[model samples]
Target: MRFLLIEDHEDLGRSVQERLMLEGHAVDLAQTLAQAREFQQAAVYDLVLLDIMLPDGDGRVFLTSQREAGNTTPVIVMTARAAISDRVGTLDMGADDYITKPFDYAELEARCRAILRRRGGVADTRHRHADLTFDPLAGTIEVNGETRELRSRELRLLEVFLGAPGRILSKDHLCDRLFSFSEPVSDNAIEVYVGRLRKKLAGSRLRIDTMRGLGYRLSGT
Candidate 1:
């Protein structure tokens, strides 16, 4: 899953971003409203972690604007405001969930998974493509009941491909999905990951096809 975390606090933002990445989800951290909006426009995120107190503006206003724009992307607001009214206000502004500051990472992860399940963003922890089964939480892949070990990057790339089988994915978009803003990634790097993934799927019905000057597509034989 791809997540956009809108947070300004350096320590908090970095911690959350790193934690999410370690959990096998691609995360993009935006420190300000402007940066968040730009990232939102560029990518389609499965969920958003929004901080209400931002440097430029209030997070509630931003959530309201996004809702008004018909952006139904699930949003979970994180704020220090623990008052009942504050919670109600955020929910009224279209936030799907609220987490108070100083909360545990475990709690946050649980809420995120629960919300995603409710929104149908992730029907389950396991995903299927042809005969291949992928468990994002366990970071494991199984084929015909046999387990296959894959590198972290390989798993991430395969997850993206399985999400949209038969769809063409551009190099730029794949780069965006695979790496975060802080990581330096090139087209050659993407090709390297794809090459590694291709070798792993050798006996599977799934195939990743390269479209020169276009991109790559994952299809079944």
Candidate 2:
């Protein structure tokens, strides 16, 4: 998932951006309401972490504009205002969730997960490309009525590729998504996994295309 973080405090904003990137999600940070508004109009994000008190304007007004423009992207509002009225007002203005300032980093992560799960309720885990089907929940790959179970790493790599389809994802990005922050993985590990996945898909029409200086993409017939 891609996220937009709208915060005025540079230090806190950087911390949140680093943490979220380590968690494997693509993130973009905006320090002012004006920048955030421009980003919202140009790019689509899975979620937005909005600060109520921005340098240029109120986060509520920006959110209200988004709503009026029919942008239904989920927003989680963060504010220093702990008063009941402030909380209620933001909620009424269309914040999916609210977190007071000085929040736990872990709790914020959990809240983001909950909002995404609620927004994109149960995406299809079964992805299809031509005659091949990848079932993530079952950890199985099928081609021409033949199926085989995959190892855990293989499954994880396949899930990321299948989920994004045509997007080019660098090996570093892939590693971040496939493993947690503390896990130890070699620099060449992604290539090794890609090789294994290619072998698994050898008999099918689907293929992982490697772009020089860029990344790999799963292209299917």
Candidate 3:
């Protein structure tokens, strides 16, 4: 899933970003509310990881604005405030979940999965296409009873394809889900990942079709 992470501290933001990337989720990191707003305006996100204290504004107020504006994207507040009032305040303000700083990364990730699962109730994390079985969260795929480790980028690529099977997804859309907003990615980078995924699914009943000038689609043979 794609996420918009609003965090001011550079170190913490980078840490969270890297951790999420390792889990095969695309993330856009914002240091201020202004940047966050820009990202929100430009792209859609499956979730938002927000920090209460930002360089330009308070995330709680931002949270309030989102609710007032009817932006229903799930948000998880990440901050150092451990007060019970802080938790209740954010939750009342529309935060789906709250995590105090110095928390475990694994716990944070678990919270993310839990929140997403609730949002997409019964959203099957496992997908099947022909003889291939893909578990995106597990970062692995099974083909003909053989299991293969899918690197992060390949995992995200396959996940996006499976989300809209048989539908053509533009390169820009794919890029949106595969790379961060600031990552310097060339067109060939996506092609490289696509080629890699093609090889990974080589013997499966599913294949990727390239629609010249349009985009790519996953089709089952």
The numbered model that scores best in lDDT is: 3
lDDT of 2 by residue, 12-109 (tens): 99899878766655567899988876776655677899998887998899999888888898999998899999889998988999999999999999
For each candidate, give its TM-score against the true structure. Answer: 0.88, 0.64, 0.91
25-115 per-residue lDDT for model 1 (tens digits): 7889999999998987788898999999899999999999999999999999999989999999899989999999999999999898788
**Residue pairs in collision within model 3:** none
Question: In candidate 1, how many Å is residue 206 off?
Answer: 1.1
Model 1, residue pairs in steric clash: none
Higher-scoring candidate on TM-score, 2 or 3: 3
How far off is residue 111 in model 2, in Å? 0.6
Locate the minimum summed-lDDT window of 10 residues in model 3: 120-129
Candidate 3 structure quality by residue, lDDT tens digits, 20-104: 9878788999999999999988988999999989889899999999999999999999999999998998999999999999889
Clashes of each: 0, 0, 0
Question: Which of the predicted structures, 1 or 3, would earn the higher lDDT when compared with the native?
Answer: 3
Off by over 4 Å in 1: 121-123
Model 1, residue 138: distance off in Å is 1.9
